[model samples]
Target: MTAMMDREAFEAALRQIGAERYHHLHPFQQMLQNGQLSREQVQAWALNRYYYQSQIPVKDSHILARLQTTELRREWRQRIIDHDGQEASEGQPAQRGGIEKWIALTDGVGLDRAYVESGAGILPGTRFAVDAYVHFVQEKTLLEAIASSLTELFSPNVIGTRVRGMLEHYDFISRETLAYFDKRPVQAKRDSDFALEYCLENARRPEEQEAVLNALRFKCHVLWAQLDALCFAYVAPGLTPADAWQPGTAEKENPRS
Candidate 1:
């Protein structure tokens, strides 16, 4: 059997998975960051990505439920709140959540919010990949589930590149429209720091450490698979699924343009 790695080595191994397999390296993401895709392609991306965005809190909720300690649950609860937002109180204004911000992004890209939320037109590949992620957290051990979230360790950099590229290259993309990303780097850092600490401390045995590493790899694949679906359906031969969203169909007037 393989020997257990020290905490430092195990953390390094986890980061290595993101370096090797994160979707930031995908061709579709590269084109997106470089301003190579067309307006319709960008719209398609926004619309489809909304599905993933909406499900993040759901995934986190599953993790929160499995946590045994109030301390852990309290930390995990912030993830759901970050995505779901808070309601207006007697004296305070409502805080916009990540999902609402993402909807605004879709609106900025000219997709009707209702249509995007309906999930009626997303690719089968996207649905399957995202659903798999949700199920993974629900079924896996708590350590593995938290380890899967280690993907966030790599997101701040990619978000920076994407935000810059879209603003520079796409006339239809605005910093306001892409607000969902602006706050993500900080949030991702906080969340990932906690998750990484949890994973390192919990994965005490060799087999457990290996499981943590594999969980991170699986998450990378989940993200990569979503981009693969986008590239295949939108960028290449463009054989969009019959039921999947078409470029011009169900679009609103692009005010940003």
Candidate 2:
């Protein structure tokens, strides 16, 4: 924007970016949420997505390492804990992180956890998109990095839609299987509130505001690109990309795993 917007206007602009460009609007997401995809296709989505889920803490850690204040680090460290899990204490069992919960979802869908965790079957496009997101956080200004995380603002609604739709349509999907989403809405709100407030406070110049807006847009592209790759390779054209997972192949690696 040529003129810097007021804080409310800036937040509105960010939400507009999510409305117009978020992956929830993508065809592959529609197919997965609405149960238009087969079980094998769902397996593929879960397995490939495990890479993204696993890397969340890695991205957050990069951001945490760069924060200059203990208060900011304290505020941000919960994100890492939420994804990576806190270790067990004297009386408590170890809590599985989101990555582990995602593995449960994969297992619920009949995939091998070791194979999924190996990143052995992930698509090229998926890897590229997730790596770009991590690098965006690592290389960008702290303000821009925080801005990119504002995608969390729109996630609660999409997660609700996905959880409900998957439960209603897929017999194999149980509440327990989709448990990874159970706490996400609340966690996302906490994270996005902190991120949005950070952006509003830090982005003071007109050019800075524009950069923040563009950072969010870039984050949206990271999401949209993953679905685009998935649809072309597995959903419509149905041609698995070279070296990517194929559901029915008899190779010893077993892409379906």
The lDDT values for all models are 0.91, 0.88
lDDT of 1 by residue, 56-134 (tens): 9999999999999999999999999999999999999998999999999999988887799999999998999999999
How would you encode candidate 2's per-residue C-alpha lDDT over 1-257 as one tens digit per residue?
49989989988888899999988999889988998998778888888889999989999999999999999999999998888876799999888788878988887887876778888788899999999999999999999998989999999999999999999989978898899999999999999999999999999999999999999999999889988888878887887887887885312254234
Which candidate wins on TM-score? 1
Best by lDDT: 1
TM-score of model 2 vs. true structure: 0.95
TM-score of each: 0.97, 0.95
Q: Model 2, residue 84: displacement in angstroms? A: 0.9
lDDT accuracy of residue 202 in candidate 1 = 88
